[model samples]
Target: MSGGRFRPLAGVLAATAVALTGTRVSAIALPWYVLGTTGSAAWTGVVAFAEMVPYVLVKALTGPLVDRVGPRRISLAADVVSAVAAGAVVLLDALGALPLGALIALVVVIGAGRGPGDLAKEIMIPEAAGRAGMPLERATGLMGVTERLAQTVGPAAGGAVVGLFGALPSLGLSAVFFALGSMVVGLALPRGMGHSAPAPADKLGSGSGSGSAPEFGSGSGSESESGERVTPAPRRGAGSEEGYWRRFGEGMAFLRGEPLLLTVIAMVCVTNLLDAAFGQVLGPVWAKESGHGPVLLGLCGSVMGLTAVGGSLVAAAVAHRLPRRPVLFAAFLIAGPPRFLFLAFDLPVVAIVAVFAVGGFCGGFLNPILGAVSFERVPRHLLGRVGGLQTSLSHVGVPLGGLLAGAAVTVAGLAPVLLACGAAYVLALGLTGLRPEWREMDRLRARPATARPTADGPVSDGSSGAEGRVGVRE
Candidate 1:
């Protein structure tokens, strides 16, 4: 890894470690909290919906804010908020004042904070990864690994904390982690590092030699005619003080214009929605009802996390060698059905582990490949907006998934609900309609070695890009 990017890289993982600790603790608590409180499955669903709806909406809406503020600032602020929110939960629980309504509201607050926190953290990585000169695929693959590492370690840790101590301690533990993460990123980043734009002098010279300001819209630094140098923009990819809606439109238009990148996001949305139902809400209920306790649930989480790590390693090692479309399509194809079957059959420990492992493996493969596509397709000028939009779209299914599962569980039972979810995954993954548009994704992973990204940067791919041209994250 390039030394320049290492600090940022560490910042991201540290933030993740903090964030996931909170999520795992919360995840460990969700089903039990609801069941303990109301004793009604329907009410459990409502809480899930309440928590996820805000998370989804906040994530979708915050794209421009992230773009405007810079991911580093956003990331740092989010960590602090997450820490504070988690800390509040511990205090509330301790005072014998915790109620389901208060708990749900607090969760909503945490979820909202998590949305931007996650976006900022993910957006910051590409800049650092780019500086490292790591191949986009390798960088994204490692990102997938980082997520899996958190998933693998976090739940087990949360389980141990909750079991050995209680939810209050677990929440407090999460707070400490997030607080530390905030400190590291807020203080440790080299000032203005990974925020390069072309010097204005280079832009003027390059444009005068060829095109105009419209063509050189981004990378807007200027050298003074009188020999004084102007300061560069504080954040990379920010445009002139354009109207937020207009800027939002432009981001949307960018994604609409990119067919393959758009497809990847759509695929992610579908899978995310279904998985949200299967993995997020229903799965926990199933585990709890299956005569297995929180410890078993924790074991299940650990297995999935470990397998996801393996999958990330596999993708990192071999992804660049494969064609992008097929790799991506195959990953989605493998991810969905295993969970349904695993639960449908009520498999033994080894079997259950195998099912989750496969799901995690496929999920691990999905992120890097999808991330590579996202990072490569969008210009540096719109990274934050695109990243935010991608995240928003990817998470769109969550609330609905939780709601749908809530209703479905009452009618079809959890096993049948899972089976239905598996079908939904296959449908979404298959809808991309494999085409010539995304055929060369791997080949385009880096701007052709011969041609540098021009001062103006690359335009959307002529035909395909126009279709999915809105908010295509890079």
Candidate 2:
């Protein structure tokens, strides 16, 4: 492990923050632009669906490819594609040549690129942490903090830019950010930052089998002999189509056996759906109806984001000492229903801001918990494919969210739809929070002892091999 210079970790965080900021900014600008131009809530939803459908689908399918090709190249290529796609939207709109079909198509390209790009960044975290000689918990906490900061600032900046200069400028700025993000990833990090060395031929079978080393916790600062920290470069022949499917299948099988992760995925899917509706359609519609326009939209988002950053910082300091289950349940309880109800009641802007800030604060801690669990439990080599699968599964409802909310608003009106969604959110949280499997969240075990590395990779003393082991705490 590298002594505490932490250079690669800093670069990874910077790149992720910049890229996510661009995406968040685009997220705000795009929907507002659609609503302003079309004056149809339904069309707004359609545009959102166009982007997210490709995002979820492509992300799901690209997991194995990310594992095979390496995250750095995929990340660079994805950001470049995103920049071009966003720039094209700006160019076409400026030329007055942007048809609805063309706009949607370009947005689709942006979403497609984002899927793999985001996954590639995520896959770099543990590797970066290991290289920096930092604990996984601290590294992931910092990662959560970086993301929250972007989320805090991005939408507000987008809204302000749209309010003062129009949406085109926001789109142009998104392209610039994406371009910058690509440069950071391509040039800022060291050569071997997240690269994997190929596995020795004789150890291939042992590395791929179920007996591979069981992941304990985030590693100590020392390099293990069994390849615990280093991902075994999949054998060269693993590039075949059959090999891809086999690896993909292994990822799925690994997920199936982990009940806690599945529970998280299911809960996240519903939450993501509701969030999509709120961010893309409901909030903007409410702002317009209230005669607040983009400035107030920016204000509300900024307040929420700033508070969320505070919450994330607090989590980084104290999360390990808190009770996981009750805290999470309470956070969800505070975060979800109130925002919808505030909108449903047509509360004052001040009231909305206050509620939103509180909700955002509670919401910030959730991701660190999720990231810690994932990083600690998942094997190093499987990070890309497994992270992709889990994220894709959790995002499955995102495309439907905007579409459903828009259609509902068009048919029944906004207040009723808001109330209905709020009620559903409460029920979903309640049901899942009370489930037996969810108890697992409260019971994650710390690493017992160090496992020695073998020729096959880091294997627990009693385990057969490292590749096949899926670490699930009761």
Candidate 3:
């Protein structure tokens, strides 16, 4: 592909990297800061709950708006909001005026902004992939690589900054990253990239087959090849409650029909919950209890992230050639259980590091496979709403994860809670795997279905009763 074609994808990836790095840094800095200051696990959990609840709720509600307004605009605007909120947290702390309630409120703002911002970036992925003539798996794999690289760098940097200068400085750096991410989306992307998805009635040609990118503006029209401006189809009840609910319902209905997607969401919800518990409560507590402190915590995360980057790079090269089901199953098996077990056992720092490294490598293969499947399944026009709903549902348990973990640890202590969580993780996956819908993971149609409106409802073209290929090579 020409550099022009690839530039949008590059910009999106760059923006995603910068933004995620900041998030990862905050992930470390905030929890450590809370734990250190309050010396209470329950309070730490409360802070996590405050942030993620708003994150899930806002992301769930913003899908239609993202579709109508354009992901690029939403992403840029959201990042700016995040920067300001994060900056406020740092500023308040510097002045020693930061109360617990104030900190929670600021993080809530940050989470609210992040919800749509992250969704917008994800909404751009398929379009970016098409622009570059890249396979979906490769594009998602590259995205995974970018995320892992941020994970690798962010934690280490956060730990160093916090250790050397304090949590305030690390938070200030996070604000800087958020600002940079906004700038990239604003200035680095091609002029015509990350536009709103066309309505069904618009009759615009689908996909990037013509090799023409969408114009970057938020206008309700695009210029056609004949140099005429093609107006968008009028949105029914646009900006009204009826329109938002209708769009939300459409996304929910689409999800309900896809048993495979539903099953994936169910499974992901459990894992995400467990992962949140680990990140927010169990991991930090373990670090403190084991006398490893923030430096060792960062070291473990860095080692895992580095290996995950390598794994993602390999996945980017060859994931399309792999069978989706077996790879996903194996990766989850390796990635989920052992980390908890090792930590629960209070193993030596070296042993914990090794386990994390191995687990992260396997974990890296996950997103590319799942992302490819999701992109292939959903129609392009509904990408924003569907993607947002899927993400929101999958994250439903995240807010509670920390609260549950913290309360469990406070009452029963850390090791027992860790063991129980690991057991629950295994159970959740094993139970979900038995469902017949999981077989669909390896079966995909040649292309995503195109939506066509009928008197009754929207229908998917070329998808009903079609035979599916066994792998994601297309």
- Count of residue pairs whose backbone atoms collide, per candidate: 18, 12, 0
Residue-wise lDDT of candidate 2 within 1-474, one digit each (tens)?
444467778888899889878987887799889988998888999998998888888877787887777778888999999999999999999899999999999999999998888777766776776677676556766766677677667878899999999888998999998998999998867765555543222211111212222332222112246433333444454444446776677667667766766777777677678777877788788878778887787667667767777877887678767877787778777777788888888677789788878877887666655554554445555555676777777778888888998999999998998889889889988887777876555444333212211110010000000000111000
lDDT for each residue of candidate 1 in 1-474, tens digit (9 for 90 to 100): 546557666666676666655666566666555655576666677777777787767866777776666667777787788778778877887798888788778778777877777677666665665566654344545555666666677678776776677556766777777787788777666555334552222121110121111111333222344322232333434354766776677567666766665665666566666666664467667866786756666666767778867876877677767776776667656656666656766678788777667766765565555554544445445555665676677567666766777778877788777777777667766666455565646545432221111111111100000101121111
Best-performing candidate as measured by TM-score? 2
387, model 3: CA deviation in Å?
0.4
Between candidates 1 and 2, the one scoring higher on lDDT is 2
- TM-score versus the correct structure, for each prediction: 0.81, 0.85, 0.84
Cα lDDT tens digits, model 3, 1-474, are: 578888788989999889978887887888889998999998889898888898888988888888767789899999999999999998888899999999999999999998888888866776777688775556666766777787788888888888888888898898999999999998877654656334443222222111111332222234466433333443553433346777777677766766776777778777778878888888889988988887888778778788877776777677777877788778777777777777988577788888888877877677666665564455555666776777777778888988888888999999999899889878987998899987665545322222221100111000000000111100
Task: Give the worst 10-residue stretch by lDDT in candidate 1.
Answer: 458-467
Q: Give candidate 1's root-mean-square deviation (CA, Å).
A: 7.8
User: In terms of TM-score, which candidate is stronger, 1 or 3?
Assistant: 3
Model number with the top lDDT: 3
lDDT of 2 at 101: 97
Q: Report how far residue 2 has shifted in candidate 1, in Å.
A: 9.7
Model 1 stretches astray by more than 4 angstroms: 1-5, 130-138, 166-168, 191-240, 433-474
What TM-score does model 1 achieve against the real structure? 0.81
In candidate 1, how many Å is residue 35 off?
Answer: 2.6
